[model samples]
Target: MAEQNVPIQRMTIIRTLLLFLAWFNQFLSMNGYSPLPFSDQELEVGVSMLVTFVVSIWTWWKNNDITKKARSRTEYLKGKGIM
Candidate 1:
């Protein structure tokens, strides 16, 4: 059970970092600055962040759906006096 939580924790950290990066990039752009003094680097980081955000949302949705189904099944079984 604890082992199953590791991935979720890691993903949470990754998502936080990615969001920070996205915000940092926007701040730099608004201030006429760049992290690496390169135009393309910021664009790459933005694209990567967009991809990560989409993937994270998809993963969360799937996980939530699965958990909901599992919980409902457990409740149904309990109602039937099976466990």
Candidate 2:
């Protein structure tokens, strides 16, 4: 069975959204606007999640190309009875 790879472009989009959300939240805070009445701790958690999401996305993007290449190599090897 072949392992599936995450699409880097989709992850990039998700990362962008996470970053935008974090920035928008901060912007609202600076303007003294509270949309949902979230606590400081909850805001902190939101930032943490954004950071984690971006980091994971970066990691996946970094590895996706390598994973595709490896899969192609594996297919070639199997075709040549080298696996």
Candidate 3:
């Protein structure tokens, strides 16, 4: 389907921002950003990286021209420039 050129909603902006923050938190917590030790740090880092990967894949699947889509505050690396 042809995509619309109209701007998206502001609520979408707010919601996307929240989602990005939540993902970043996971990325931090999983990396043992605080009290977690080095051994557990690996686990956290692995989980965060995996989550990041999944988000990027999902975003690409949702939008064929990923770069052409509107800027969203999502945490996926693929959506970086747009955001």
TM-score on alpha carbons, each prediction: 0.37, 0.39, 0.35
Q: Model 3 off-target regions past 4 Å?
A: 1-4, 35-83
Clashing pairs in 2: none
Candidate 2, 1-83: lDDT as tens digits: 89899577988999999999989989987998986677989989998999999999999987664577788987898999997
- Candidate 1 residue 30 Cα shift, in angstroms, is 0.3
* Per-model lDDT: 0.83, 0.87, 0.76
What would the TM-score be for candidate 2 when compared with the true structure?
A: 0.39
> Who wins the lDDT comparison?
2
Judged by whole-model lDDT over C-alpha atoms, candidate 1 comes out at: 0.83
List model 3 lDDT by residue over 20-50, tens digit each: 9888878988996853355767978988999
Off by over 4 Å in 1: 1-8, 36-83
lDDT of model 2 at position 70? 82
lDDT of 3 at 11: 98
**What tens-digit string does per-residue lDDT give for candidate 1 at 14-45?**
99999999999899879988666556977799
Clashing pairs in 3: 30-44
How do the candidates rank by TM-score, highest first?
A: 2, 1, 3
